[model samples]
Target chain A: MIRKALIPVFMLMVTFPIALLLLLSFGKSWVYPNIFPDQFTLQHWNDIYQINSELLMVTLKSIGISLGVSSVVTLLSFFSSKHISYSVYKSRWLFLAYIPYVFSPVILAATLQFYFTFVDVSGTFFGVILAQLFITYPFGVLIFSNFWNPRIKAIAELSNTLGGNSWITFYKVVLPLSKGVLLLCFFQVFLISWFEYGLTALIGVGKIKTLTLSVFQYIQEANIFLAALASCLLIIPPMILLYLNKRFIFTNQQTI
Target chain B: MTNQLLDIQNLSKAFEDEHILTQTSFFLQESKTLSILGKSGSGKTTLLKIIAGLEKQDNGTILLENNDITTLSAHKRNIVYLYQDALLFPHLNVFENIAFGLKLRKINAQEVKNRVTKMLYDLELQKHIHKMPTQLSGGQRQRVSFGRALIIQPKILLLDEPFGALDVDTRKQMQRLCKETLKQYKITTLFVTHDLKEALIMGDQIGKMQSGVLKTFKNKEEFLNDPSTGIKEEIEFWKNIHANEE
Candidate 1:
């Protein structure tokens, strides 16, 4: 019975904040002790794009950098896990999945800050993406470990027996078969980089500001309505994504 | 010797100190089926995998049509192993699964379509041309697997208990399909099974594996007459049980 109630509780936890944000975005100067706003207006929602044009640009940039990070990390971690899994010595190095994610992203960024400066990408978009990869890439690597199992290896060998070269088999069989996990990894990494604050601030030196930083900026300024709008913006994409593709993270059956 | 399609000499393999296959030698004639009977853990699957070049044997020479293919890679060996699991590529449609080998060989799309369509009709899976593996039944999955294996026209077909996981009716149906497919393709086949009935039903020549060693007989009579198989006693035991029940 309690378990049945938990979902309703969770739904309230999600919708109550969004409901308040919706009310705030439309409220005209809501203040404490005013159970309802003295006036209702679309002022904040209307001004969201017009007055806060920079928020729009920052959100776009956030998406761009997150996609870049997701793409590179997907490929990088794929090859990383593939190499470690397919090592000639047959020694499994699953530890690669742990190390990067184990470290705090801020500490990881600070540790690699000097190297980013030497590479002349610090305070740049590329540097910001690199900082986020420190967390996302390990997750991708761990997600792809399932693709390198003995059953899958046997499938690869079967491909070979059917006259496919390694490259051909990878393209036709391995990649197609792993499409589910790959999409999962890509979106998971995208969400991580999307909401990422610490690494972006540290490595980009606050120059490459994202929407997440803008929400923080509004909070610090005590602009509750704008902060609520920006927070909703940050939360909305992942919510829609999770709703549309729940199997991308949750399913256990190994079908494509 | 001229009739021989595959010949193995002094084959041996071990995992740690546990010997898996010991001096296993066999000869398969052109277009003949050789069935090996062994219990689980009797190294039946390992032996077939070694022959298909998926696994390396510690000592052996495999000659296919008088060519030494022992050092050849699995890709170059022209031998295909059908896993008992019927591992159809889950993402691919039935047509694509059947066309997988030809596509890998870089066959043209038109030819691939022609061949796959014909194979689909031949396997009586024309209605499921666009269906994924998950949508297929157990028997349909095996037919698709058989279609994939036979469409390639491989030099040797190694079947490792292809019917092991099916129910009684499905297993019988699969055996019929296997018999029809092999007869149509005329592929030299190495079929390993623990089922005595399946062994006799599938093989032109019969062999048995015991304690990592293999013995092959020239014909079914010879195999049935062999004392180690316990076929005589097995029949008598069933007969006596029936008598007692009566």
Candidate 2:
């Protein structure tokens, strides 16, 4: 019972820093000697808007890239999972498909950097999206495959007997049944894409900028206020998306 | 016969070195039901799977209305197999699960709605149409499974112990419901069960299988009364098992 009570306390502890960052973004700065800032102002927030449009463009670009990566990863995972689940070589190929995810991100990125340079697609959005998709695709496949394999053949048979062709069975019967898993996959890929830094920085070079990049830049410049403000801004959109996702998706269903 | 919906000839199947079925043959006229009875490893489920095209037979031919479907892929055979556990898609509600086949066929919204609504009413699942599979009672989920399979109007329905997961009373109720629904639809069915009583109640003809060969009889009376067969021993085995359980 005490353990249960401590959980909420722990959660509050974890969230305190984020809350403090939000507070700091509203023009409040806390010095080490004092318990609280002497004055609270919105100067940092205003400074962000006034100083540069790069942040705004970067935010929008991050959203687009994340969405693009999520969609592509979802599609690739969906088909590959379907194939793996139904194929005769499921056990063998499934193990092979997981190799990319099991490898360290830095190693994978370094390997891809060599490959991307060779292919002449280095430092492009496409290159970053592709790299990220590879990282996220296995997770998608693993999630969907866990649900699809044992159930797909049975459901497909049921659909076919009911006058449904293969495509119809997939779209109507299989897809609807897999809605929960797909939503989960989408969110997972989105999160991975949004906060991903190592692969993006390595592959995207200096041309592409994301919110994570902006946060890193401000922190490097020793502007703790700006960095905290940027981190707060970076965190808001994903939190809102996650909130909406939890509210609307799954709808009381426990996804496998 | 012209009306014989399914005919199996010298069907045999092996998994690795273990023989599941050997030289098994059967015939089912349209709208008739057959039950396969056996012990746990007696290959009753394997037989059903082979007929449903989910499992391959090593050396036999399966004819669906005189059309060879022995080599047909499961998706092309249109033989619906219900699992012991109702494998209703967890993400879809009862109505949507039942409507899955129609939607797959690209049936328009109105027709799909009309058919699914009637099926829900027919199965007495109207109130639970919006409920997820997990929220349903075992009997309710089996009924949804039944409706999901029936809505597709398959060439033949293969039941792999559909009510096996329910409690005894609920199992009895589901069995009765299944019998009534099959009669109403006049759909050909092959039900596999280890329960002799269930087979007697649901099967138009009962085929007792031992090892891999099937010994078929026309009805319950012959199945129980045939002196040359091992029906008595099978019944005694079940009786002792149940008695021990009690």
Best by lDDT: 1
lDDT value, residue A126 of candidate 2: 85
Q: What is the DockQ of the complex in model 2?
A: 0.41
In angstroms, the error of model 1 at A251 is 13
Tens digits of lDDT, candidate 2, B29-115: 788788888889988888888887767789999999899988877777878888887878766788888887777667899999998
Cα-based lDDT for every prediction: 0.85, 0.82
Off by over 4 Å in 2: A1-16, A23-52, A85-102, A250-256, B1-3, B16-19, B55-59, B70-78, B89-135, B147-155, B210-212, B218-222, B225-229, B234-246
DockQ of each: 0.58, 0.41
Residue-wise C-alpha lDDT for candidate 2, range A160-230, written one tens digit per residue: 55556777777866777667777778888898899999889989887888889889988899767777878
What is candidate 1's CA lDDT for residue B123? 85
Quote the B-chain TM-score, candidate 1.
Answer: 0.97
TM-score, candidate 2, is 0.81
